[model samples]
Target chain A: MLRLNNIHAFYGHVHALRGVSLEVPKGKIISLLGGNGAGKSSTLNIISRLIQPKEGSYELEGTSMLRKSAGEMVKHGVIQCPENRRVFPLLTVEENLKIGAYIRKDKNIKSDMEKVFTYFPRLQERLQQKAGTLSGGEQQMLAIGRSLMGKPKLLLLDEPSLGIAPILVREIFKIIKEINDEGTAILLVEQNAHMAMEISDYSYILENGRVALEGNSKDLKDNDEVRKLYLGA
Target chain B: MQIIVSGLIFGCIYGLAALGLVLIYKTTDLVNFAQGEMAMVTTFVSFTFLSQFEMGYTTSFLLALLFAAVFGAIVHQGIMKRLQSAPPLNQLVVTLGLFMVFNGLAGLIWGHKPAGYPQAIKGDSIKMGSVFFTPNEIFVMGITLTLMLIFFVIFRYTKVGLAMRASAQDIKASQLMGIKVTNVFTATWAVGAILGGVAGMMTAPITFLDTHMMFDVLIMAFAAAVLGGFLSLPGAVVGGLIIGVFENLIAFYLSPELKLVYTFLLIIIVLYIRPQGIFGGTQSVKKV
Candidate 1:
């Protein structure tokens, strides 16, 4: 479980997150839906400790996380599948997965890798192939699979559906739901509002660095303003 | 045959020095202009151990390598680490600054005059057909080959090597994977400096130890790195060897004075044709 209180982040003179607050409950899929420059990615970045909020109380199950570095966040089981599948281009697919478990000293890494293969069988077929040579869909799978290798309790996914084909996007969303069903808390940032609302239990709509709307996914999906603005119904 | 053999011996030295430059550049994306000076200082350290402390040649050599490793780590932590977030031009300028500092310090302490340096193994040159190999030449080749083999194994098989490769390829992605990228970078600098120190020690006996001992070798090593494709480790070694033999051939058959000009011309032509060098990947032109 993760909680943010009045988090305000800045990029020089530009205030990116203006008094934004949110919560991700244990074993739940929480979607943060927003347009461009709405601070969706910034919120995910803050949770992952990639960017620090100038003003905020960030807590992971009651322990303050503001002091932790981005590298230390992974050790705390906060794995981020960053935007645009940033797999190491020169390294093999197998090496990319191994690097994900960089902080883990357990003997179960091989078994964990096997578990990832179950989620993305295509990756197993191309284990020795360089990651850069993978197709966008395959790269996305590798990115998600790589994060799973960390055995994260809290997964921060920033725009998993971006640039992905519609058919494969559905497949990835299906796997994302399955991952959440298995008990990992997910904070998904998405532009694909229809799919995100369909999968997520709770949703927050952000506009101009502020939370404009928050409700159960079902209620938000049926809301007239949400349908007109995001869902395009 | 003699020209090629001598060229190869010198090539091994350039390759060893180039290895350090390439390693640091690959991981940190900063071309260390001070690599030659670092090696120069380390050689001076070894000379002091041998002459002043009366240490054995082996002891002095190993101690110099150890000193290089620590010196490299300190340089990275103290200076390079601070410049990590700065612009690439700034980082490069800092290394150039370090070059002047190290060169000045070595001159101040060791004096400007060249000093005779002992070879690792002093013996008669062994003849094989038309070619003759000195004991020191053999030692240099053996050490270079061994270090190359060791580096190959480490890069291909070790965890640290994987981290280094990952970090080199994508720093942000490596961080997401929980890799201590700074530590990997620090390790690279340490290993790279050790390689440079080995090169300096080997080169000293042939050229004589002085503040400017590594100047020509460093330039040749740069040429080698460019020839091999700066990104590839094996490429740097191959590039060094090619430059060594080519330079020697030009000196023997053509004109020694024009060898440097020909070398650069050859590089310019190769780069003109391939752009990425021999071992480098084709440039990925990103869409704006």
Candidate 2:
């Protein structure tokens, strides 16, 4: 569903991603695993066009995303539920969800928002409450709800489990699987290796800005090397 | 006491002007140093309708506001849109350039000589014990206060206002949600420009219309906006009034020459103590 070929990303002089490439098929949960500064987040950012790649070609389905402005990208169905739950903390739960669907000019917004609230019942109960006041788990749910409102065909979720309680992490992973089951392809980046492998159909292990290994999740889970370094078996 | 009464009136006008600045800045994250200039130009448009077009005075004033909004939208689409993702410094310079352009345009169009626009409301200056106020000045304050009320209402009740705020907080995110972010930005500039125009038009009768009239008020309007915590509408209103009354009291008690110095000091002290102003919460700190 998505492809990045020879992508090179930089922050001034420091190279963040050095000639990296990856691909994903349609309607599948693809997990990118890495430690800090492994370019996992950077890959998601490049696909979402939040940060421009110094040199690379990215094709979503088939069209090159290079020529599109951020506003244009939303129409192409590559939306991001950014890390740190960058929900508009000052805005209410409803307002934050409305923001997720900003690029839509359709009259079906009310229905879309209803769908979001249905997916996240906590958001419905706290619709008027400020997002910042919500618990970390609740905010993560709201963030995912907000992205779902965008109705992206390919969603890039960045560390949705980060900073949330462990129990909440499992719940969030279950919801992500539900979202993937509903036909929206997902590119999930996570530090929680076990859950990512559990939910993702295909997984890529990233280290030092390059893909170190790629395989089916069950095989990766059974692999001794991954078990030793990442799984801690 | 006279200083206090008059201070309230002048403060209301400054508050409206500062509101204009804050609205544009909130969305674009741009200080818009040329905001005063935008006001100057729009008010001049009013000056044209009233003096040259021979239209009814009230009608001219209303038309001037419409003209200002349109002018603001044009400037946004043509100029500000290009600078949307540009660095703050570059955007700042663009507005500073606009400041010079608008001021220079005013000078070129109407010579450096200042002109006084006629007031619609006229009556004897009312005296209440130690205070004094003309009916027209009171009317001007009423107009400003009414505009502020309208702003509050629109911001609270309207979908457009909510969308505008959402866009300001997260432009890219808002865009994904199907909000035309460019339209929001344009609307902000339009509101800001119309406000500046009104301030210029109303204040022209109080302080003669000249290219530099708004310039003198720039620092204080900016100070008021910054002091308001840079994001809150109510904060801008309160901040502007505080600065206005304070400046007037200084002029009454001390010397007129020291008034600018006093307001300047107020700004520095406010920023030093609370860099976020009164309402703005710092989120993204741009890399220097």
Please give, for residues B172-241, the per-residue lDDT of candidate 1 as tens digits.
8788888888989999999999999999999999899999999998999998888788878888898898
Report model 1's TM-score to 2 decimal places: 0.97
Candidate 1: residue B177 lDDT (0-100): 84
**What TM-score does each of the candidates earn?**
0.97, 0.83
Pick the lDDT winner: 1
Top-TM-score structure, candidate number: 1
Docking class of 2: acceptable
* lDDT value for model 2: 0.84
Model 1 chain A lowest lDDT segment of ten = A41-50
Docking class of 1: medium
Q: In candidate 2, what are the lDDT values of residues B172-258, reduced to their tens digit?
A: 566555567898899999999988888777677878889998976677778888888778888888888988899999998988899
Q: Score the docking of each candidate (DockQ).
A: 0.79, 0.36
Cα lDDT tens digits for candidate 1, A1-233: 79999999998889999989999999999999999999998898888787889997999999999999888999999999999999988889999999889889999999999999999999999999999999999999999999999999999998999898999999999999999999999999999999999999999999999999999999999999999999888
Model 2: reference contacts kept, as a fraction: 0.43
Show pairs that collide, candidate 1. none
